[model samples]
Target: MGHLWVIPAGPPLGSALVEKSEVVIRNFFLPFLFIRIGLLTDIFSIKDWKAFVSLGMILVAAYLGKVWGSLLSLIWFKTSTRNDLLFGCFLNIKGIIELLVFLRWIIYKPIDVQTFSTLVLFNLVLTAIVTPLISIFYKPRKRLDRISKIDNCIRTLQSTLPNSELRILCCIHHEDNVNGIINLLRASNPTEMNPICAYAVHLIDLVGRALPVIVPYNTQKRRLVANSTDRIMRAMTRYSKGSGAAVKVQPFKMISPYNTMHQSICKLVEDNLIPLVLLPFHENGEFQSRTACVQNFNKNVLSYAPCTVGIFVDRGLTYYHPSNICYNVAVFFLGGPDDREAMALVSRISSHPGMSITIFRIDLLENSVESENDRCLDDAVTKEFMVGNVGNTRVECHEMVANDSKQLMDAIKKEKDFELVIVDFAEGHMMSLLVIQSVESIKQGAKLLPP
Candidate 1:
């Protein structure tokens, strides 16, 4: 009745009461009851599986029957295969209520001591096993469908406006992340013709919470939504207002489980038809690495995001100052879809008057030529940039051959004056083996790499 009647009615007090009651029962009642049961049971009796085979068979039959029946009933709802399995696993649990019923049966002597012990053990083992299984197998089916639709919408938008407005989804962890993202956006150089539409999400980790909420953030009554008093939202609003009419920023606050927040971020990006997602590097500015959870979130987001993604490692972004700074950006083109995407991004940034870009196309002699088809795609993107972005004069391209790690290191060491170095993150799903080899070599020779 606590979970069923109280929660659905939408009263905060009722939910709080229920949660408190659950805590009391779990902490005060259950442990004492379990201790009593343990004191009564004989370990020697549990070892007599042959004698308790009749009771064991009944437990197996009951457990399997419930699981199969639950799965069959769920099929009518058109749920994904994962949900069906998770539902079945959940139904298999014989939890606190069942434990209480067995205790009453034992007290009334409706069951023998041996039978009671066997059933108690069965209940304990089944619940423990099913709890972990439910967590492991539960994949929210709606999230996947949402991602698919987002991909379709983004593809349509890109085809329609190839050289125009670049829609970007930016993720902000806290107030500290706000300046870094804003500076990077400023460096991207938004203009009146080819503008930037940014959607910023203030990611909040939901701890001891039952619901996930997405709230739009602003200086109005909207702040009441999702208990949001976000400093990041305020900062982003200021940045958008000061940046002129060319750049548009939409601020949102998202609350989700830290472990699975990447799914929510990806869904939002897809829904908004965002072409690029700008994420902060997992390492903080103070030379401290963030938590493992954050690092994994970045990795998972890259795998699930439908659009191009860039991890911004903010090195002060001093080049963005308009008065006297000339931003020099160097992109290492290792050859792949991600590499092409990085080059396209650099070209977009190069449109700004104060920014100059250099494209370093690294050629591995051993694995130089693949297929005509792949080569055509890479060549087409490069040719398109040259032909279309002709008004921007400060751009250069270079071809270099590096057969081994030593040569790759030597090649990278040549660029000493670049303010920003952009490299395609390799080891993605579609990355070729040759590209992986070169990426590894670059990673191994990181001291020669630029800041």
Candidate 2:
């Protein structure tokens, strides 16, 4: 009856209430109940040879029963052997409810004290070993690492085929992220010739649930919808419809623990052959407690992602647009594979009618030495971009030489106000530091100046 009511009544109880209830039950009730049960059970009662033989039989019978049942059920689904075995191990973990049933059977004289003790010991042993067993059999991180090596060869915009569909995985954290993501998608300028396939995943932290689930919006059966998720889905639908055949949106809700979420994401990317992933920047306000977890999640995604991972720092791209004005965008090219990827995306965004782009090719004067092969690759990409955008008034390219960090800062400041700025994630570069400082200064100047 409780399970039947959950479909219709679960959301009304509120996630907060459900989470608190789970915490109380897990941390307080279960431990206390287990202690009480331990006090009632006698380990010495099962010392006889007959009791020892019965205990051994029970352990074998229980484990084999669960494993055989799991294998039979999973064979029809064609799941992996490891998964089948893991599921069987999981089923062997008997919780408090099962212990209560055993106690009741003992009270009713249906099961002897030795049998009850053996069953309890069986449960304890299974529960203790299941986690380690699963860890040994199923290594998600290792699987992802293998996938990363295979995907690195082709999972990038620069390597994408010409006039082919662009697949992007967009991760949304909340309603605040919806508008920024939609705006970014629009700015990509999807068209009939170069269509986009967007997978918008709404990420929800796992709470009050034992297993994580990924639900597709169209296949969901629940009548009550989460407001934030509903809004995100509706916005994605609207964008898909408005873009006609240019954009195809597939929305999904992923409820998972942050610790293992990256594995799921990387798997999706590998399966779909997606070339890019867009993650929202972890904000430092309101949800401060979640910031660290989100930051860690982002780091893991970057580390394990099978494709290019972009952290979008949205600075009012959706709210600051004015009518009949071209959106100004600036791209800083520091000359690397990451920067080349940024340029590839910039080429796409520059196609938007309302966008005007300025490409700043910055070269350091002090440590200007680059490998001959690397310089040729950079020149090839830049030359291709310049040749393609030749005679296009909306696109402008500037070659600048910076002698030091201060000169880099001054060079960036000379550019006009831009609504969006794109930079590569090249570590250990002084240019990255200067760009960050310049962006902050720009934000301060914007606040100080009137609209």
Candidate 3:
């Protein structure tokens, strides 16, 4: 078999879970022995020394059985000590599996007093505590290519969907521009999916009452929470038609009291397993600072969101719908994993079966570079992804004679009409300013007339 096929799918829950898995592996005897001790702790059980000795012997046998089996295989197979030890440790993590065996024995009425009682309490509490953590380290086999593209998938979605509607999650403060946003969602001809959902997870303090955050136990109390979320959704749906691409409002619980709005938005996306259009108000100034988004906050909800997070600007260069005209969309690539991912995403969106794209890239031209090779020019777009040019479509790797950010913007504005200049691999802060300037130009209706 190929080395790739042998590779496990990701270790989910990341380093924290992995570290815990290692702990579970290292301290392999404690939890199990404690469970055995718990069975002996029962007052109705054996009152003699022989009974305790027998129980201890069985525990010792099981321990040696696992450790010896691992050591023998490791020494015989002969790889690295570290690898062998890790494999041995990983193999002996039998919290859930052992309990399952014990349960089955009890069901058949064949289990003895000691084994039955030990396994019962073991499965119920201690094993339950640690097994899930151990399971995190082992993953089902999958392609490395697939793993590299999408980070941790919370759940693999069964129903494949073609997204059409611009899904928006509106956080209404005082509800001023709320109507405008709803109207925009209503106007768009979205397919199959709902357009917008105005959700309000309000922060409130209940006087002289404290609700415990206990799942399954708090099921009855959670029904009241459903009403608020349902009401907002109904209201948004009411304004537009109750069905089809309609704007809907929803509210969720402020599950974590201290979670920042950004992180909450991210977590909400992850928890629900959906792409969320975040409608945060974008002003004429700079966007929210990185620190402000998720700093000093104990938990980050926004950082770990699975799906695409779209932040819609309230005003300024609105290119949400750009009149369906061929505009120069110049993409910059700096050559890395991030750049590669960006290229892949763009190619998926623009490339098709027969048609070509008017893709542009930046290149530096230098004279007297080389004799035969003369490889001074840099073509950022990889050849495999770029198809041949057709009609008005041409892949122009613009030789950088002399053009900074503003100059590049001016050149594109002066030379050709563009829907929106999408830069793929830019330094984050610099990109923000370029985007703002481009938006301003769009707002002013300044035209280059004709190139």
Clashes of each: 0, 0, 5
Tens digits of per-residue lDDT, candidate 3, 1-451, equal: 4564232222222323444566776589657755654544453553455765676577657645765677676567876554444455555456556765665675577855555665454345434544564466433212222321345532221111324333334443223334444433433333244243444343211111223121111212435334433444345546545544444445443322233344455545445555433333333234234223222221122224343322333442333322232323444443333344334434433432221233444432322232332122223335545542333244554434323555544545554544333332222211111111233444332211111
Q: Which pairs clash inside model 2?
A: none
Cα lDDT of model 1 by residue, 1-451, tens digit: 2564424421244445655687887789889998887766655556666868988898899888876877785569776666666777777774667877887887889986777788887887887788888767665645554554433435422242645887878888766677767777787778778788889887766643567777787555554434333566677777778778768888887767657887888778766777777776565645344456566776667656666666665545563454344777777776766666666666667767777877787876655655777678778877777776676678888888899746876778765556667776534422111111122333432322122
Candidate 3 clash figure, as a count? 5
Decide which is better by TM-score, 1 or 3.
Answer: 1
lDDT of 1 at 233: 69
User: Deviation in angstroms for 361 in model 2?
Assistant: 2.2
lDDT value, residue 295 of candidate 3: 26
Whole-model Cα lDDT of every candidate shown, in order: 0.66, 0.75, 0.39
Highest lDDT against the true fold, candidate: 2
Candidates ranked, most accurate by TM-score first: 2, 1, 3
In model 2, which range of ten residues has the least summed lDDT?
Answer: 429-438
Worst 10 residues of 3 by lDDT: 428-437
TM-scores of all models?
Answer: 0.71, 0.81, 0.35
How much does each candidate deviate from the true structure in C-alpha RMSD?
A: 7.3, 5.6, 16.2
The global Cα lDDT (0 to 1) of model 2 is 0.75
User: Which whole-number lDDT from 0 to 100 does residue 396 have in model 3?
Assistant: 52
